[model samples]
Target: MVSTTFEDLNNSKKKLITDALLNEFSHHTLSTAQVSRIVKESGIARGAFYKYFDNLTDAYNYLYHFALQDIHQTITTDYHKKFQPDDYVDQVREFTEKSTNSRYFELVKMHLLFNEAHFSTPVSNHLIIENEFYWATQVLIHDAIKQLMLDPSSKELILQKLANVLHRLAKEDD
Candidate 1:
């Protein structure tokens, strides 16, 4: 989350900073990114950047959450609703199809595979095990999609294999 100073910025100013951050992170992974570059590109002073976020990780998390918000809006997932394996697969498939169309999809996948320190830790108050199961499945889907991207020729075969594996996994819940 951005600091109150950032949230309070006028819409145009906010949009400028957001666009600059998105472009910066889109082109470079966290380990290779530089705040000085972002500040120079955004035409803002280094102090302004710090005023909005604690550090690069904080800025990255804010942008990452922004991407997730877009994804959730594109595909509705009710956390409170009962879980069904088939429905879960369908939702993942839908997200996979739609998400690939976005410009930030590549960056999002890179963040997933490369950023080990940022995984969400589920709260323990309710359905903690269920949350872990879903999180694991999400990770599997990300890895499968990334693999498919790397070998476009094997996409159909790999997708079929994944479906078969998921089918077997779903049956275990019976």
Candidate 2:
């Protein structure tokens, strides 16, 4: 995601730095993520990372925003028009189907599979905070309701269950 943004960054060095940041952030949470690994993986000096971004958290935040922007453009703008909360189910099903075979879907699945426990921990501790996830999920459910693909009440129930499951996944101590 961030890679495309930095693809024509007009600065080759900066592009490499951004790619490395994105890779590391995707693989690890902010707490357990390491800057040295990114530096090594990016083939840049350790100091180069600091030069491009303020710190690991800053880089993560930036990449986070970048990924969300892409997700929004891909799902909302590409296939749908207005956001009708009632049509959420159809939207979710449609988008899910499309994304099911896409690299994006696979990436999301990988994140969910690997980071379940990490995310659940923060959620349990009231520390899991990211608008991207919330917005993405909301969009999914909202569309489902708007499309009448799923019962409104059922959609709400599933969303609630998702929140709890996410929390447990993140907080489960290994």
Model 2 ranges with Cα > 4 A deviation? 1-14, 77-83, 90-174
- The residue-by-residue lDDT of candidate 2 on 119-152, one tens digit each, is 3332334323434444454544533433322243
Q: How far out, in Å, is residue 160 in model 1? A: 2.7
Which ten-residue region of model 1 has the weakest summed lDDT? 119-128
Superposed by TM-score, candidate 1 places the C-alpha of residue 28 at a distance from the truth, in angstroms, of 1.5
lDDT of each: 0.71, 0.52
* Candidate 1 whole-model C-alpha lDDT, 0 to 1: 0.71
Q: What is the overall TM-score of model 2 with all chains considered together? A: 0.48
**Per-model TM against the reference:** 0.79, 0.48
lDDT of 1 by residue, 41-102 (tens): 88899999999999998898888778767766757667656545566556666665555667
lDDT of 2: 0.52
